[model samples]
Target: MKNITCIEDLRQIHKRRVPKAFFDYADRGSYAEETLRANRSDMERIKFRQRILVDVASRSLNTTILGEPAALPLILAPIGLTGMQHSDGEIHACRAAHAAGIPYTLSTMSICSIEDVASSVDKPFWFQLYVMKDRGFVKALIERAIAAKCSALVLTVDLQVIGQRHADIKNGMTVPPQWTLSKFIDFASKPSWVSGVLRGKRRTFGNLVDAMKGSNVNELSVWIASQFDQSLNWKDVEWIRSIWPGKLIIKGILDVADAKEAVKTGAQAMVVSNHGGRQLDGAPSSISVLPEIVQEVGGQTEILFDGGIRSGQDVMRALALGAKSCMIGRAYVHGLGAGGQDGVATAIDVISKELSTTMGLCGVNRIEDIDRRVLTDHLQTNAVSSPRN
Candidate 1:
């Protein structure tokens, strides 16, 4: 705790806490790893122009996401099996995010169910849904979210087909970890993780297990694999919109054409993402194509950005280039994997301070005032030239 200062610091601690297999699942990416590497590198390439002598004392990181006030311009993006990262991880992350005044999104494949988080937290959190082939179960999931009073319904338009992660195939990853001879060796080294998981409320996918009675991890994986609807299309958004009356956010938009189509779905906001470089191995990094997508649909629909956002400086860069807000996945997962709820709280705290400092250095007093003027001329030409609506 005394040495923790950044998200990567927690990441190293997390690596030491969890088993090698689960850590690789969260940390690695799809085949060839080109897009995964590019996500971070591309963000790093964007330079900033510093300004001083402009009343730098006062600054604000306060902003809004889908009409709800936030402590900062950040949201915890959904990550599957977050509960496996640390016992009851989703609940801990939700409480920490709610306490920090930012939104937390629960994944459809989370180890903790929707009801589990709704019952624990006082305020409503966002929910992320993967459109499955099982429309009946999908509709039931939507009703569950509505019944829990979720503030927003994030429709992840990507991952209609699962990306082949080489690490996952090699590790033999499962929901409730199977302690085979190979896994046993890995689990033996992670006593803390095992103890925490053994003491947790639920081990396997809490949302799916009851519904999938008489099924084990192998069967559950097979069922989930068959559920990803390769035929998912824009019409599904209309169907979802008909059922979910709350704010709808279409995530995983990376192309200008897709951004235009997303706006037609009547969504309040759309996240410009490439699935954190997890799917489509050779796709352009989310940050690189953000300006193009924003330019095509900037005024039509609010654009939220994700992928390769590790620091508050990255957050300011995305916002300056026409993103209304940014979502973080690996950063908070590092916190959760490293130190449970306290680590998550610390991750938010670190980013808040960094974003505030970056804002002040760029001569802005409020997050709303951030624009391309803060960027170098080169970035300005390549990025959105104006603020987003």
Candidate 2:
């Protein structure tokens, strides 16, 4: 217990340090959470085929995401309200990721603004955009990202409709948290988290503050719900691609039909995600659907997988299944919540070590060499056999 070794250690520590509501926000999924549970369970069921008597030294996790070199085939996924996790949470996570040689994604709904992360980190990070009905604002947002020199523009295509996470509504989740008696009492108990929150300034949604004319919480709520474009379609992607001349990544592709459509968009990459199982409760887990999507459009577009990624082996599983890279949302969030930038670094370290060691045991030294042959009996038939170049 003294030496934290796994993500669950961070999550348990995070659960005690932060308010229950925010923890639930990061940890829980949609109604019933069947898909959320499945993400992990299905991944665990994929038993690895242990190999030996092969040279295992000099293993590497280095790979490219969207053609950019990464120290590891992992990206710190964008999660909203990261600042609440541990003062300037996005900035801390960015710093940790940069140091760890992985890319960090900043969310549109992040507590820290786009500029905040841009100014804080030295290297270019990815920016995730939630298509809003306000074309004018969306255009400006794109310009801002361009101005910040964000390396990639990640277009999150899944959240046209926000799924109802029962815990969030029940907890009355809000940024610059509302101080109801129970919530206040819970918040008061965690002095470390409170200190972090108080010491920092970018508390609420920083990107929206100036854009919404510094609107208050209630007004901001109205603006958000009204702005999320419910009618987002392929036409809009063309519109965005025309305007934003940069590497484009479409997040949240779960179906073969949708994956095929996404490939035709000329997107350099697509994340196979179900919004971390937060959108549709009964939908299949990201790993479960990854192979089908790969079969549909594997070589046509770069495939990045997300949802229920807990460890380095999870990363290995995804790669063998044809994913070029994997994104960890809750895994690193647990780290961030548990110990800020240190926690994030720790999360990355744990995964990197796990991945390298797993590769050694599997007789795969280079990440690029990881193929379907390393998987158990049933998976070898469908696994990618070799990582994509």
Candidate 3:
């Protein structure tokens, strides 16, 4: 194969290798996709200042996240059905993240079970949780992560109601996708993906099946659909904090008020994400809200930025805006879909290089040196006047 140097290249290859349903499931966003498009566009709008005539040697991307050292300020965000991107996808991705000296978060809805990943990899990975109504199952899942020696627990709190992704509805996306004539024809066109799937276990939500009582692949979808508790409140967050002993992260905090609440719940960190624009179509981009959230809670808790982070420059932008670290979903998912382990490694390399190059251009030698001065916000010119003033 050719050198996959950029995320776009991986996306193209992924389109060629994975089935349409699975590819779109990872690639596309919810209705209108306004926030998704805005996430990228907003990053582009924040232009960096270029500098010259300095001995730009020995740059470092090293930083600390959640009190642990990281090779860079990037973490692999948990993406469900990672296995469908490639066989044993979660395991391979986790391995790649470990090799790169970064943290890998395994989703509660992943195709690989917690033990499956733990047994296959040497180091511990973070586990993401979506609070379910089944208190027993929730307790078991947390215990499983603990048994797996996970160092962190990321509690995703935004997806109380699943957003309507048009592509998912159109593709009839599910675990072990329904065998329709259209899907079969799509699969036929991708023989390499077909071969990989044939060699691996069935493409069901591996983490959910055989673990939750009375739930198999056939009933998995119904169970998942019913599990997410819409009545979840701050008390639930407190309950989760009380149980999970490891580092706690409250994922999906978009508002500053909610971010403060996360801190009150004793969360060590909060990921400023809009569920990657999958939950709410009109919510502001995660990057746009990072500055305020950071300004509010930076001294008290770790702030992580997630949505629309596609390059190393994006990581820098997030840090400049006060995010301690950034997480990637579609970018890494594109890499996973393209070439599995190697693809993921290539993706990390590409972003790391991009970050280094961007840092050098902006005259910043270290990741810690990046700050708001590197960015010129055009929005400042259109400031709104307060009625009280």
Query: lDDT: which is higher, 1 or 3?
Result: 1
Taking the candidates one at a time, how many backbone clashes does each contain? 0, 2, 0
Q: Candidate 2 on 127-186: residue-level lDDT in tens? A: 999989889889989999999999999999989888899999999998767789999899
Ranking by TM-score: 1, 2, 3
Ranking by lDDT: 1, 2, 3
lDDT of 2 at 307: 86
lDDT of each: 0.89, 0.88, 0.86
Please name the candidate that would achieve the greatest lDDT relative to the true structure: 1
Pairs that clash in candidate 2? 371-385, 372-385
In angstroms, the error of model 1 at 202 is 1.0
Alpha carbon deviation, residue 33, candidate 2 (Å): 0.4
How well does model 1 score by local distance difference test? 0.89
Residues 62-133 of candidate 3 have per-residue lDDT tens digits of 999898999999999999999999998999999999999999999998988898899999999999998999
Model 3's number of clashes is 0
Error of 2 at 171 (Å): 0.5
Could you tell me every candidate's TM-score relative to the true structure?
A: 0.97, 0.96, 0.95
Of 1 and 3, the candidate ranking higher by TM-score: 1
